[model samples]
Target: MSTLTVILLSIISLMYSCKDNNTAQSEDIKEIKSSEATTQLSPNTTTTKDTISIDKSTKTNTFTSSPLDLLKQNEKAIVTLFQEASPSVVFITTSVYQRDYWSRNVYEIPRGTGSGFIWDEDGHVVTNYHVIKDASKAEITLSDHSTWQAELVGVAKEKDIAVLKIDAPKEKLKAIKKGSSNNLIVGQFVMAIGNPYGLDHTLTTGVISALGREIQSQARIPIRDIIQTDAAINPGNSGGPLLNSSGELIGVNSAIYSPSGASSGIGFAIPVDVVKWVVNDILKYGEVRRPVIGVSMVAENYTKGFGIEKGALISSIFPDSPASKSGLQGMTNSRLGDVIVSLDDKEIKNNTDLILALEKYKPGDKVKLTVLRNNKEMEIDLTLGSSN
Candidate 1:
């Protein structure tokens, strides 16, 4: 072959080899791209060679925030809840129409002014029973400067709760968010929204001082499980809502344990549980069906060292009474008294324990009682009788 022909033939073979290598590299790159796309599409199918994972050792980090940061974050929410709930809280003033003793004519006298909250869209307002006691006329003033004559729907003296209805427009009614009092604890944040001393829509904040407190209503009935707060509650704050931070009504501001008729940093509220029970019974039956076990007993102190040092000393059991039928052993000679020690496996420290145990059960229910008679412990079952 000639020199020019050999050089041309060598160049053609080199060009063919370079083209083949390029084609193979392109195919390999395309396959790799396709495999990457598949892996991206199905991430679950992608697994690591090692099955066990170890903890990643990363640099420690700390977060620091200002005290006002939390307040700034929640201020708007808190304001919104207060503004929405304030309208539901109404100011109530009562007037009583009494006939002159000598004239025998009718005249109206202002009783008192207090706070209340709309219970429903039906214009039913709930307030302290003492607020409207002896009042023949009640005026309910809404947040919008609208007024309506209210009629008493129901009253629960024991709970110091009363329900009143106003013939107002449904659009004006704002019901409060009901909260559970069973979950309340000491030192939790509480807010009181009410018309204090006739100032409308006032908000006071404090912590729950205590729980399960006992107080006396104006009607002389003992209210149990009352919520104690130090939220600057005053005279006009009665019947107003004691709300949680979430703006849920936990209690009704009822009484303050102070020498002066002002906020002495100790205020009591009726728990929402009692309010619920009273309201439900009043709305359904027009009266409170208070369950009581009809039996009167002497105090253990009066019969000290007479075989009835503790527990309730059964003094008398009426004929055909539930106690009589339940075979509760009483003093047969009217001199030796049997001491009750426990009920339903619950130890009875004194008469208070017996009363507490009985309060937990309704009439017509059976309770097991453990008694101390002649220095011996004995158990007996007794059916509770109705108070009525």
Candidate 2:
């Protein structure tokens, strides 16, 4: 209990006091973080720092949301897009008149109803070709309830898209804000705005269910890179706008993979890229000029092995086709044919490879094709042909 002992005791007390202060500061920081976390704004809800209310009606307590909140915050953006695009969207109805064979009387039948959007102020409206198939008359009803008789401008059966024109005021045209479908990602929020079941301007929310979906159009040809969504799309929703969170038109609601004729939560849309291509062609050439190879072939199964064994077996090549000129052998034995093994330098695994490769070129573009003939690989160059 001398001066040195007293000084040592004082140092121990100061150390203990500092440790306690540090512990208190740590607890305060933790408390602040917890408060901040809870105070985060819920999406689609108008929550402020001064007044935060949790609605038990729409949201459950177990669901602490981050992306959900983001979706809610984007609800305004979805609504605005729908509202702005709604005016440009039109409800298309078709009428077919047929004569009753037994009664010898002609009757007007309501063919169908679908949705479409204004392409430009020139009165052109774009929609699904199936929406007006074999109809004797077509009509378009705007968001303002104004109805006009529409004339078919052009139709692209391959893309299942059609363009029509109506004699309406230029000022009434409201084209949707176009967006890139390539930028879409799976699980991102999307909204479908259309006339579902003839109910005009209906809005449904969903997320991108998948990408690069391939579906057969009304013409029974494969349409590629279709956007798949869980949005509640129905019969009348065809040709309507499928919008992104920013309210831009990313796709055109085209088909549904439902057996019930109603929404099974699986809907397909024509990607904006295809729509853009169709639109540009319809506006310029009044038709889609698809490229063709002018050759018929069967899909050769290749799971067993490679070589002439299986690939795209040439069935019949047109007399003046590029394939015929390139010396690509066709099936003369009715069962066996030369198999396409590669294009340029890329290996062709199946017919899909050849299909995808041809998409990159137009008519008259020469492409190198490697073929397997008599168990030996051979090369040939063929110029593409126009499907027109």
TM-score (all chains, Cα) for each model: 0.71, 0.72
Clash count list over all predictions: 0, 2
Please name the candidate that would achieve the greatest lDDT relative to the true structure.
Answer: 2
lDDT of each: 0.81, 0.83
- State the TM-score for model 2: 0.72
Give one digit per residue, the lDDT tens place, for model 1 in 1-388. 9999999999999999999999999999998987875555353333344552333453333356678878887777778778878888999988888999998999988888999999889888999998888888999999997989998888987678999999888888888889889999999988898888889778998999999889876665467888999999998899999999888899999999989888999999998987887787777777666554445677656767664545777766678876677666566664455667788888877765676566677767787878776677787777777654
Question: How would you encode candidate 2's per-residue C-alpha lDDT over 46-76 as one tens digit per residue?
Answer: 5555876766565535466699788987676
Off by more than 4 A, model 2: 1-75, 298-309, 331-337, 345-356
| Pairs with steric clashes in candidate 1 | none
Full-model lDDT, candidate 1: 0.81
Please provide the root mean square deviation of candidate 2 (C-alpha atoms, Å): 12.9
Candidate 2 Cα deviation (angstroms), residue 69: 12
RMSD of each: 12.9, 12.9
lDDT of 2 at 97: 94
